[model samples]
Target: MLKNKSWWSQTIQCHMQNQKSLYIFVSVLFMMGVIFGAIIVNTLDLNQKNGLINYLGYFFRQLKENSIAEPSIAFQHAVGDYLKTVGLIWILGLSVIGIPVILILIFIKGLVIGFTVGFLVNQLSWDGLWFACVSVAPQNLLAVPALIIVSVAGISFSLLLVRNRLIQHRGTIYPQFISFSFLATGMGLLLIIAAGIEAYASPWMMKEMIPQVSWITVPNGS
Candidate 1:
């Protein structure tokens, strides 16, 4: 007679298998995406940078001018960004709308990236483009995958609530928590990378690679 493993061992085995697959797949994809982003950013032009800088400068000037009257622009911007990020994280981790929220967040992320990349290419030519890229790209590569994994966990939880098909326990939450932990690990990795890039790579690029950008104003007295 063949011996059968217990339920707990089977579950642990499945989890281990899933984890190994994810580790291999996620790592390769993240690295490739980061490499491609760097290459693309390396080729942006200067006229575009100046044009974007001029427009955004005008926008910021308007923002500052309005701030003098309201003084809430800064607060509003900060609060909005924080609430969206934090609130969605919570919702996805526990709420029924987690997957859709993830989709929405992903869409927003893509758009922000598109706009930011366009702005950089237009403003900095090649150097500013690359500088902004290395500064941002390193962290984003890790964080994006984490967000998606969290979304999947939320989705799994919601599914169990609706139907106890694959999930054997409705009350237990270890699986969801485990997935969220993976997401957190990705985010933590991103933090380490972001901090290093901000402190070291940014300064080095600013000092050595940044173009000596300047504007001339000559006084006439003849």
Candidate 2:
């Protein structure tokens, strides 16, 4: 009983540490990017019930219909296309940079996410939010964390590289390697989540009476 209690305590501690670290990374992005940048972006006063929003609505509607009517190659291609964008971001962040560079990367990421969510809200009225809750939110929960991990490591490494703080021997590489490994693992997990949603949940949501749920498996028949 004592051993079991110790094990459970250790697990909780590790989980809390992980959560704290993740929160720090994500909070940095939000503080520097959206809160700072939005004042300018919103000056344009983009909002719901616009012509652009209407077009996006139509496009998403067509997407839903197509997904239900035909599960074709094009459908698979769409998932590939989105994942490619995510891969590009990871690659860029891996190159790393100083505070300015990191901020720029973070800002760019925020813009993409902000536009995506805002566009949906604009286009579909209230339903856009529901659609996003189903489609974007789940995968993003994983993907954003992975992105933050990658970006933080990249920025750290890049700063070290720029300062020529390279270790004289290979032994020092272990710590850096370990850090990158964790971040890469996070990225892989997020990609898996995204793929699962694309292959399984998204299609099923359209065809069957289901919302985009987590790890929901629909059998072949009935």
The candidate maximizing lDDT is 2
Each candidate: what lDDT? 0.49, 0.53
Per-residue lDDT over 1-222 for candidate 2, one digit per residue giving the tens place of the 0 to 100 score: 999668645743553475566447655765556444434434444553354545544444455455433444544664575456445544554453344565566666666666665655543446656665666666667666555655555555455454444543223445655655555555565666666665556655533322322122223222
Measured with C-alpha atoms, the lDDT of residue 113 in candidate 2 is 62
* Model 1 TM-score on a 0 to 1 scale: 0.50
List ranges where model 2 is wrong by over 4 Å. Answer: 1-26, 31-51, 67-102, 122-125, 162-171, 203-222
Worst 10 residues of 1 by lDDT: 213-222
lDDT (Cα, tens digit) per residue for candidate 1, span 1-222: 123235434644554466565445444544454445445544557776455566644533443343222324433443344335644665665655465665555555544555565455545567546755664465455445544444444455555555543445446666656655554444444444444544444444433433332121211212
Clashing pairs in 2: none
Q: Residue 52 CA error for candidate 2 (Å)?
A: 1.9
Model 2 C-alpha lDDT versus the unseen true structure? 0.53
